[model samples]
Target: MAHRIAVAGATGQVGREIIKTLAEREFPAADVSALASGRAVGGSISFGERNLSVGAVERHDWASTDLVFLAPGTTGPVTLARKAVAAGCVVIDVTGMSDPDAPVVVPEVNPGALAANPRIVASPVAGAILLSLVLHPLQALGGLVRIVATSLQPVSGAGKDAMDELFSQTRGVFVNDTATPEQFTKPIAFNLIPHVGGFGEGGLTDEEEAIAEDTSRLLGGVAVAATCVRVPVFIGQSLSVHASFDRPIDEAEAREAIRGAPGLTLLDRRDDGGYVTPLETVGEDPVFVSRLRVDPTGPNGIALWCAGDNLRKGGALNAVQIAEELARRGALRG
Candidate 1:
């Protein structure tokens, strides 16, 4: 039987990607609805050959929906997810608003966690998504002890408004026009912003905290430290991850392990600089890992660079993948 699906925040970047991915994957959807805030109402979005008119989410009856993909910014997703699930819809939330009670899932890492709650599945953050794919192979070989990562995040990580700001600022700089900074506190045209989100206690930005916590949760490991930064890039998110394990690790063995892992592409070529970059992986679905160097700092430490499309693997694609898995398993409303 085909499932009836509704996409919340359907006009946003991640939301649109979810719709595109659903169509690309040919999910069994008998009915599909696109929902957005009042401001985006009347706007039209194309889904394959059909054009879906944007409807106000507040005015929709979500109870009839079988599954709802909530891709709104941080604030809206959680509330809408709760409502959708309470109305008998399975909710897949791409936003980072996770409850301690809910499973923070990276499907490649833990598909079993989805079985615990039929109501909601919380997608991990971009950094967590990249790290989980990289660490999965390592974790299979040996237990992971610690991980240190630094993210070179793009403007799109902040949201669509941030991307707009960067584009306008870059154009202004090119034409010698005065540009104003609004989406970000600092100019993002020619410069990088060390800060990504609001700062919390102990001087960690919210993005960093989310990355660190979600990485640990997704990997099922307690020891992980992450330092996230927002760079000048536009689409992809890159991470330099250094992981320490309990046993000895060989480089060739590590490469073999990564090659066998699902949803990961190993681009490690030790001969004269053959590594993956953010530009190379901007639109790619799989996590790209290269520059695999055996860390001399610890007994079984390995350092690798990882990159993936933040909009796809990090947010939208992951959510759609989870939905597909659920559908395949007859977990979505039947």
Candidate 2:
């Protein structure tokens, strides 16, 4: 049975990727509707040869759609999500709208969490998604007692505007001109920002807090300390994870566990150029892990670095996987 699909925020990076992924995966859909702001309406986007004219979400009819992929952006699906769910449509949110009441999910780490939720599911942010994928496998070995993570997130995680900011800033610098900060608080070209979100009470940015919260949520309550930073790169997100377990885990044991974990690609070597980087992870699906070693600081510690495509597994791809999970469980009755 073919289901009618809707991709909201269609003109944005994640939204465009969702539509591309749908076609690449050869998804069985009765039809796909691209919805966005008024500015993007009537502009056609190509999905595997089919030209789809963008529909202004405000004026478009949601009655014909059965499932909605809410892409990442400020225009969160809050108002629209309510309207869609009220109409009996399943919604997979790509944006980081915590929605305290809604279930936060990373299919590989917590598909079960999403199964019980009705109408809408919130996907974790790029840092959380990439971090959780690596941590979940370690859980089966013993149990994660403590997790300390540092993320090197690219501008792509901020959407198309941030990417443009980085590009324009870099070009301006080369020509002896400086691009003003428009989308970001600081100039992103040739610079790394330690802050990804606004500072809160404990000096923790919302992005940092979100990483800790989302990781714990997916790991079933394991404590996590996260530090998120924005790098100057255009794509890919990387993380340096320090995991402490109940029992001791040697380098061999840690490597074996991660190597066998599904949706994760292990590539650890010692000599120069042994680990993974954001540049190598672009357009890739699996979370690439490298720099595996035992942290001497903790009683039972394992430290490693991992990277993955933020636009794919981090955002659009995860949402698509959730949609697939919903179908497998008959959650999308429509």
- In order of listing, the candidates' clash counts read 0, 0
Per-residue accuracy of model 1 over 1-334 as CA lDDT, tens digit each: 7999988888888888888888888889988898988678899888878989988888779878999888855336666777787889898877767345567888888888878656888888888999988898888888999998998899887778998888998999979988788988889898977888889989888888888888888888658877777777889999998999989898888989999999999887777768887878776899998998789987899999999999889988899889888887788775
Q: Write the per-residue lDDT of candidate 2 for residues 1-334, one digit (tens) a residue.
A: 6778999898888899899888888777889998888578889888888989998888757888899888975255788888888888988877766256678888878888865756888888888898889978888887889999999989987878899899999999989996688878888899888989889999999999988998888888889888888999999999999999999888887788888887899988888998889999888989999998989997999898999999999988888888888887887755
Clashing pairs in 1: none
Positional deviation of residue 30's Cα in model 1 after best superposition, in angstroms: 0.8
Model 2 residue 59 CA deviation (Å) reads 1.9
Model 2's alpha-carbon lDDT is 0.86
231, model 2: CA deviation in Å?
A: 0.7
Off by over 4 Å in 2: 74-76
